[model samples]
Target chain A: MLDFSLNKIFVEGNTDQKMIATILEIHYNISFPYNGLALEDCIINCNGWQGLFKQVALKEIYRIESSGKNLIIFDADNTSNLGGYTKRKKEIEVGFAELIKATKKNINYSIYLLPNDSDNGDLESFYMSCIKPDKRFFIECWNNLYGCLQSKNEARYELKIPKSAGMVYSYVDLFENYRTGFYQNKKTKRDYSDDGLWEYNFEENNHLKSLCKFLEDNLNLKSN
Target chain B: MPDQSEFITHFEVSNFKKFDHLVVNDIGQFNLITGDNNVGKTSLLEALSLNLKSNNDLVFKFHSLLCDQHIHHHAENKYSKNPIIPKFNYFNLLKNKEELPLTLVFNSQKVILTDIDYFRLKEEDKDLFVSTPYFMDGIEYKYWIRIDKSNVKPEIQFMYEDDYYREDRKFESKLYKPIVKFRNFYERDLNKFIKELSQIELLNLTAFDYEEIVSIIKIVIIPDIIAINIQKINNDSDEMIFIATKSSKGLFVNVTRFGDGVQKIIRYLIEVYYAKKNGFNYFLIDEIDTGIHFSRLKIFWKEFLMLATKLNIQIFATTHSQECIEAYAQALEELGMEEKGRLIEMEEHNGKVYASTLSYENIKAGLISNTNLRGA
Candidate 1:
């Protein structure tokens, strides 16, 4: 097993990681070793509704040398104050620039953040357009499951979930399931014979091609 | 041949575009303007181009496309409360030994000059002497001339306009014709300019059209490289594959397959060649480093200096690369232009754009550990 270097690619999830791995395998014929220091790695941390932003920040700067290239992809918050996000990026950059040398070679990290003022939606919309709209059935189901979690309802874990909901997650479960069972065809949907509900666990879809495709398209992995 | 005295001597615009004021103190044989992006550097060049076109009727074809320039006015009328109202004012370019005052206050929304807009000298009001010669040409080298025969000079003066076509209805008729009315002024050899313009070539690939220069390049086969066949379709705009590699390992990618640095270098080559061939005498390129690579900056500047000196094609370009300054210094030394070639640096101070010369000596000073060359 070639240990893939943890490059900190800033992609969506494990599904994206596997799809990228498959692409490298079939196209470049190189197998990626996950978390092995010799092989490059990219650990993607999210800046979504749940502010898990701190997770992607500090330690990942070192992973840049492990990967062939490191790219940080971020989406702007189109909420109200555009400058506020810029300030946030500036804060983080200033916070990070202090650590790295002011040269190109140190990290070779290029940050790409899409502007929020677009009349159209963000990268999610772009991903949705590439696949069927109802394909995010797993995300819908995950959010549905979180919406019902009693701990999520009483305005409890305000520090964890979105400002509105509070939910503590340990398994990185949302991303794992999002990668595996994002799409549902009639047959996959009809597999709800046990409880009239099809709950997809990440390890369960190890052989499904649709799961891989969903990850590749969403994370902008090299499809060739 | 027109007398040197009769030619447009000089011009300096104040409150024009990003330039609030510029003296242009002494016009040199060659001028090269280099600075960061959007620093009012191009704005100055555009002002000069506009001034030049206003003065000369040399080889400008914009006169033939008047209808196209005004079409935007009709489109703009959709949102504006006013119905395509035109505006005009004189910069009073010509000034006698005394100080010449120029203001950009809105004179009128009228389209044509209609004789009511001249400075109106009656041999009593006391002051009227302004000759600001400029050439304002849009991309593709389109230039136009602005003239007013009814002025106190009684004789008309044509100043060249740049980047944009003048929408003034009064000067529209004068856009055509040579410098000296029915007979052209300088008797510039058309064949000479055309011969120069034609020698230039480019990758010439347009997103919408695949039939340009890209269609004519002769393909060669090389060993060990994909047979050198390229597939450039509109469908694969986002997909960039390495088409060509180093000559040692010749690959087959389309011209667009290269990095922006190589692409811009190719583009600048075409422009330089075109300018050198035709006695364009002057070039104004904005955003000189939009897609240019720092590594290739030396080659680009060297090639430009060589061609500029050989063809006597004076150029003015805006750049955001400090490397460009270094290259300019080296280029000056290479072209033996240490004494000539004006290098002007522009800066935006408190919302206003101003310029100062980045002298050859100053460039030398900065090369040795100084970061504050702006002061120099």
Candidate 2:
């Protein structure tokens, strides 16, 4: 059973859980299971934004309150119908405040919206930003294809792929050694972090820096 | 809002088994309790049964039921040969073996139980004790055991309101009898089966009641079950329940030979029908989905809710199955009787038990989002 009474991280999906676990293991020396793919002991995948709030409403926040440190990570998901970063952060604040009041317990928790705390995007956007500078042309190529498809009729472009996911997967596919078949079927987009495909330079990338600092401040980890 | 006619609108338990202090408010007509192991789902039911009425016979019956459960749990292990001997301690009923009284409140009425050392009775009280026999005096007290050198036999004193109803005094209350059923798949005794059959027969169920029960059984369990009948093989033998199925070609199969699911359905429906006929408004079932198949859960819940509504009985049932919980939510929605049901989740935190009453909307949202509502 996953212990909720631990300094915990609640994310939006399995990809976010794995990605955050990978980043923590690489930079913070915090080891997680399954080569950082499975973090069931600590990181919880809430399935979606609504699920995160559902967990809060179910008194999961009270369980985390015992540990005294908690972190929630989700997408800003700025769409035509949905709210952006400010609105998402406000939702988290209101939810936590109401739960804290109802439960009568003060919880030390932080909300970090993806890609950065202020950005109107998702985990994939952060992954796109962390792509190697040399592999930027693959993302441009996918964007060009996406733009052409967008200009055509909706029926002609029936394959409605998400832009950020397409860009990140395209960049990672560049490292695929198809001729030798060495990394042919073994590597998936989920293994990008473990395969050392993405840049994790905290000094250079501000987004990665902000996330690392957020973890440092929130989690009770050994300082390097 | 809870119906004013409900038997118990609010319930609170303190210093009882596994609950330091727990309160469940807004008691609905049909309550499905879900929790992790040892979180006091069954304990809540036991607490409610203890205070369901002011009758001393009911109290003794509850104690015997607990003793039976304890004996059954241990009968398979080291006590298999000595199954008649009880290995459970009634003192363990108190939380942490403290002397604090077990307090239970049903709505505004409070029932407090305190264990008094039998040897501590005064000389004048000793005569009262001799004249006042324990409710189980006819049968051997299964839980009456001497512990340690002082001959410490625990005696229970029930205090309701401000009056103490000692063992000698008979409790007189107009409270309706609450039917309590536990999951006892091992109850294959011929006499007990006959007793249940006799009880159902005494209910004087009309043809319509029998038809409703048989149709529900057919819908939720065996589709071929045409009717249920009680038959005696000969004058020398006792009566037994038999199931007449469409495929049996007029042959009646003894109910004892049927599967556990069939037997459980028969037992449950009979109890509910008997309770309704007897003017009982409360029905408590522990492990309500014990023998029923997972696929039939939704229909069983639908029928259960419909019956409870029609009978105007409040039902408290405990379950550990997530499928059962989901089926209950689906049944409530399908019947549009969401307001009549509540999913109670009992959880223990910091050594104190708490019950969170989830409405239909809350339960639906949790199920849709795949939340761990059963505490798993």
Candidate 3:
């Protein structure tokens, strides 16, 4: 069972959960199954933005009586019709305010919009930015093919999938020959952090550094 | 149905069993209390029952019931055959031995229960207690039950102030007259069930009430039950409840032969019908889902809430089943009377018990989001 008594990080999807868990483990040497049953216990996947907002509105985030930290991570999804970083943050703040009013517990929590909190994109945007400079050609080639398909109006027919997920899948497949889609099947799902294909050079990427700082300030080691 | 305006809207308990101080506000017509084990859910029901303004005999009866003491009836005294003297340790009711009095407040009416040592009183004072009514000024009309150290049995007495007339004197001072019906989980008294059945027959209920009761029983208990009858056997020595189902043909089968779930639901519905006919406005049930099957919980809650609304009775029931809580929320939504139900989550923190009242909106949100509202 998930140990809700400890600190928690509520993410939008399973990929986000994997990504955050990987970032914490790689950067800070933090490990999973932190006082819980498995690696994904501390970081909960709310399934989607709707599920996350529903949890907030239901005051579920304040269910436990712990002074541990809580981090909420969701994609800005700026490319879609959904709102960007500022708007998503504000929506969460409003829902969180209502929850606080209902529960009245002193919760230590913070919100981080995906792709460096201020970007108008998601975890895919962050991962694309963190790719090794030498390995950038793989994503660039995929993007060029994607643009050609869009010019011929064959993008929907040929790709018919999320562009970022396709780019990540193709990039990882080029080196590992995994041939599997990103987050397609649970049994053969890829671990974004454990995979050595992606180069998360935090020293070179300021956006990644900012996220690490935010995590370092919020995710305490005492809970683990 | 009784007037709905007179129900208790709020209650507070101080120094009661398992609660140093607990306050539950915004009480609705239907309340489902939930918590972890030993969190005092049943004690809250007992506190509510004891807070009711009842006569001395009824008060002692409630005390005995709370203490789990069996009252013995003697054939020698006809009028007072069943003398309910509290036979348990009185200190068990207190939160601590030093906490002098346990106070229960229902709305504005307050009941203070204090235990006094019988051996501490002066000899003259003891002689006065055995004689005529002991009158004193500014006594505050408390139920002073003194327990003898040697026997550990309480001597029940009621003291009044000087201005109170002898004819106007009674136990508990008649602050609130709402009749309370309590049902426990373990004890299924067949004699009490038969008594309630006779009372329901004497109530002369209308056809609609009888039909509603029968339909509720059919929906929640046995779907094949066609008719119910009470028969006396062994030369009127005992009464038995018999039911005729579709499978039973024209003959009636004794209810004792069926499973406990059927008998429990029947006894509960009959008692509730009788209490409603007699103008009862409050019902407290401990472990309300004990004998019933899990699959029948939704229908049971639906029918139970409908009956409570029709009878205008405020219900306070404790539950350990998550399905029961979910069923209650669903039933409230199905009836479109979401405002009438509340879930009181009792929790213990730092040696004090607290209750968090969740409205229908909160409960629905939690249920939809799959949140743990049972405080487990």
Scored by TM-score, the top model is: 2
Instruction: Give the per-residue lDDT digits (tens) of candidate 1, residues A66-90.
Output: 4334444444344433423465456
Better of 2 and 3 by TM-score: 2
Q: How far does residue B342 in candidate 1 sit from its true spot (Å)?
A: 3.5
Q: When only chain A is evaluated, what TM-score does every model earn?
A: 0.37, 0.80, 0.79
* Lowest-sum lDDT 10-residue window in model 1 chain B: B178-187
- What's the TM-score, to 2 decimals, of chain B in model 3? 0.72
Please give the range of 10 consecutive residues that has the lowest summed lDDT in model 3 chain B: B72-81
User: Between 1 and 2, whose lDDT is larger?
Assistant: 2
Model 2: lDDT to the true structure: 0.65
Question: What does candidate 3's lDDT look like per residue over B81-193, in tens digits?
Answer: 12233333343334335444567677876666643242243333322333446332213223233322334443332221211234433332222222233343223466555
lDDT: worst 10-residue window of model 2 chain B: B156-165
Candidate 3 pairs with clashing backbones: none
Q: Candidate 3 on A85-155: residue-level lDDT in tens?
A: 98888888887677667566665678888788887888787888766676778777887888877677665
* TM-score, one value per model: 0.35, 0.74, 0.71
Per-candidate Cα lDDT values, in order, are 0.38, 0.65, 0.64
